[model samples]
Target: MNGTDLLALLPEGWRRVPLKATCNFFVSNVDKHSFDDELPVRLCNYTDVYKNDRVSPDMELMAATATPQEIERFHLEVGDVVITKDSESWNDIAVPAYVEGTADDFVCGYHLAFIRPRKEVLDGRFLFRCLQSRPVALQLELEATGVTRYGLPKDSIGLAVLSLPPLPAQVRIANYLDGEIARIDGLIAEKERMLGLLEEKRAALISRVVTRGLDPNAPLKPSDQDWLGEVPAHWEVQPIKYLAVVGNGSTPSVENASYWSDDGYPWLNSSVVNEPLVIKASRFVTETALKECHLPKIQPPAVLVGITGQGRTRALSSLLGIEATINQHLAFIKPHCDALHPGYLCHWLGHAYAFLRSDSDGAGSTKGAITCEQLANMRIPVPPTGEQLEICAHIRKSLDVAEPLQSEIQNSLNLLMERRAALITAAVTGQIPLEELQP
Candidate 1:
């Protein structure tokens, strides 16, 4: 199971086949309906299935008026696979799921499609898993035809092929996966908990650094800033303009549109900075566009922040190291790294983010922005240089511990997801024996 590709792991005498060949198409269209009582059948949707391969009956929305008799022809036999034909994004468009119990007989909207396998040819759960693999997503993407965005069209899936395993082996593979995935899932959950705890600890460490400095025994006094409340007696409150410079961004003409090609100068938007450290941006701008707009290239890792748009979004600031341009929705802040201690400023800015953002003097508009004057008045408590370094050092150590925990959490979850995928692949392809399955 650990050493082979899904195809290599299959049992003897199994054959790979396209979905079009072995299963009867189980579909129903929208027809006039009625609804007073709750439908007995459990309805399902693409959302009902998770990327983790977990099924949620809660996503089920019922139409009591749906025709039970009409639905019967489309009835899901235990082991039938259900799929979603369309989704908001290509990544979400197709989700294949295994059906069990009365949910098999439930009515679905126009977006869902079901497949009931012919007994001698394929396993229901196995086929569903194959439809979810990276290979399947690639196939689905190739078939999409939308002008604005891609999707998983039913036409492509109608002709899709998959490996079919013998029944007993299919059962064994599914059972093995059920147990294996459960253990992986447990570990992933634990890692996630550790990550949450790590984040909390980091946040607390920063708060302590910015407020108390490195000396827990340092003399303390009340802070004049309303939100800050108190700080170390030696700490001094100073305006941001004294410590940093802020700049805005611009967009060039879109009518001529020559600057819209993929290979262009990188452009960073506020949304791009909405994540911590703002590592990447979604779009690129042409050199011509940047020149036309007369926008200067922003120094990376300079603590770019969003000041004018997207209400109450976090990560308004990011620490970047590359050169890029930003949109009007953001403000690029260049810290006096030599004297101010850049890491300390980034951490302190993060702490005062909510209060500083609220203090901005924009119009009564939903998106609040501050003028240069308002920014110049934005006060932050400045601990002595030595203490600032101490605080920054503590922060670095805390992040060192936190970041790896977060990575482990994601890795564990990824392993569970992959194992789940492999299980589905093996079951459908008859890599395991069903009679050997205990449940």
Candidate 2:
């Protein structure tokens, strides 16, 4: 990231200059707090910068209070660039979001840097594109400091170098990029929308098969529970407690070093529920920790459910493919009877995800937790063992057909993102000629 190395990376017409030479930059300390003495302002917070390419007037910003001095010093304006100065990882450091348009009250919030390009030497849009480029971005990443939480020091931000083109050329490149990027973004949005539809289809398929038998003309019977509605006539509708041994586990004390080891008993947390099948442990707990914590070692053919979480995590289910112990936030259901297949049970739980979440919210738990007792009492449709296996096979076959299509769409998305980044880098660095974009 030295001047010579950066200059070498740029084309002949482009010259390298320190970022501070082309822009006025400052790190903001104004936080998301309101005081009676301070004036009210709409704050462009860290997420606003991290999640968007441009911060515009249409986006809803956080409401906070800032002192007159802070308001004067940190007020946002058009053509200004906001970058994340601090993050949990180095890759996220110095992620820039341009201020496309802003209100008078909009001020930069904490953990972000406000950069205004010196218009005589740099076009704001072009500078923003340069920041998105790999050559300049890599410099910021290398300068980031900290072990757990990374940050770009003010000196590093000021010293970072950029490939500068002539003002007219910068404007031309920016304009070309703006149009091209929009098209790519539109394509990406469509691919993402398709992914959403696929997910909905997958969920619907699982829900339908688990609740109803594979036979199209199967007779239906009322299951008493509103959520259960009508199930296959031959299937038994009963509380889970009758078919499985439902229980939970606990975490060992982290303060005791002996509780954790690299080679020890496999231990999992509620996040395991995110995976359709849990085949490996998240971490390891020592033998003494397992005994002292009274953690139950759940065997295979068990269904794991995230019983506690604030977001969509609650009621998410996963099939345990390996012997493991879980934290208290997870409930393990080990089928004790011969009639129920763990796969079928997991699918049923997946189908019941929304209902379980609703139940958790209405149970009057302030934290939105589903207890072991609640899970145990929940009703499920139980088809014959033979039918359950066939249904599981059918679901897997359906997934096999859908999985490739999803992967193909995902690959297309990856390529589009790569192309977008490469195009921005090429244009900003003058590697691609402006004439190429002309009709």
Question: RMSD to the native, candidate 1?
Answer: 8.3
Q: lDDT tens string, model 1, 235-293?
A: 88888788888777866555557655576777776565556676565567787787788
Query: lDDT tens digits, residues 266-329, model 2?
Result: 9987777889989987579998988888999888989999887554668999999999898888
Error of 2 at 382 (Å): 4.5
Cα RMSD to native, each candidate? 8.3, 5.3
Q: Note the clash tally of each candidate.
A: 20, 0
lDDT of each: 0.65, 0.88
Worst 10 residues of 2 by lDDT: 358-367
Q: What residue runs in model 1 are displaced by over 4 Å at the alpha carbon?
A: 1-128, 141-161, 164-175, 219-229, 233-257, 260-264, 268-284, 292-296, 305-317, 326-332, 336-341, 349-387, 398-439
